[model samples]
Target: MKRYDPALYAILALIFALSCAYVPLAGRGGGEMTIEVVRDGKTEFRAPLGDVPEMLEFRGPEGYNAISSVEGVRMVSADCPGGDCIRAGTIKNAGESIICLPHRLTVKLTKESASEMDAVSY
Candidate 1:
């Protein structure tokens, strides 16, 4: 077998680190964002995230959830056994989501369109 140099491993490690760091940033963008509530693959609620009512309630298979859509979207409270969904925190970025497995519920943020500033003028 041919012997390999340590430099090769170091280069691979650097590439992996940079790619992992960029993956999260790639999911974020400046645009008009909306909150989508999906239950069992069906869209139940969809609205501008920041413009939604201060408090919204949803009934799921497991129980109920109180959602807050102030500046961002979040599950303020839920009747599920585990409070993981509520602990998922606010989702202000496009492509972010909170899933409640037991309740078969998902709250996601979607970008309606890329902001004009993201375009380059010739």
Candidate 2:
């Protein structure tokens, strides 16, 4: 029969606690942005934009699509089955987006910028 060592268990528990403590520090100074598509006040699609084109092709299963740029964001396509989202074209701004009535999807862009000092905590 094999016996478990209490010291080993304690060390493993300590390691897990340290890792959990560090999780919040991972986001110290890095900014994150989420683009959400909504219709009738319901969220449909969300995307992160490092560039304009990457945001253009973001799509969700519920017939939602979104695109974004430094200036704005919009919906370029959707799978609402009526193709209304496709006609909306592109939008480049913070609060700009396109919605499809049939599919009940909306696309919007959000940005988050954190100060560099936050990194020091990590």
Which has the greatest TM-score? 1
Q: By how many angstroms RMSD does model 2 differ from the true structure?
A: 11.4
Instruction: Name the lDDT value of residue 15 in candidate 2.
Output: 100
Q: Taking the tens digit of each residue's C-alpha lDDT, what string does model 1 give over 38-90?
A: 99999999987767889989986579988888777788989888889999998
lDDT of 2 by residue, 10-95 (tens): 99999999999898766555455556756568664455655335545534445454444445554555556777666776665444
Candidate 1 local Cα displacement, residue 82, angstroms: 1.1
lDDT of 1 at 74: 85
Please list the C-alpha lDDT of all candidates, in the order they appear: 0.82, 0.58
TM-score of each: 0.64, 0.40
User: What is candidate 1's TM-score against the reference?
Assistant: 0.64
Global Cα lDDT for candidate 2: 0.58
Candidate 2: segments with Cα more than 4 A from true spot: 1-33, 44-47, 51-77, 111-122
Backbone clash pairs for candidate 1 read none
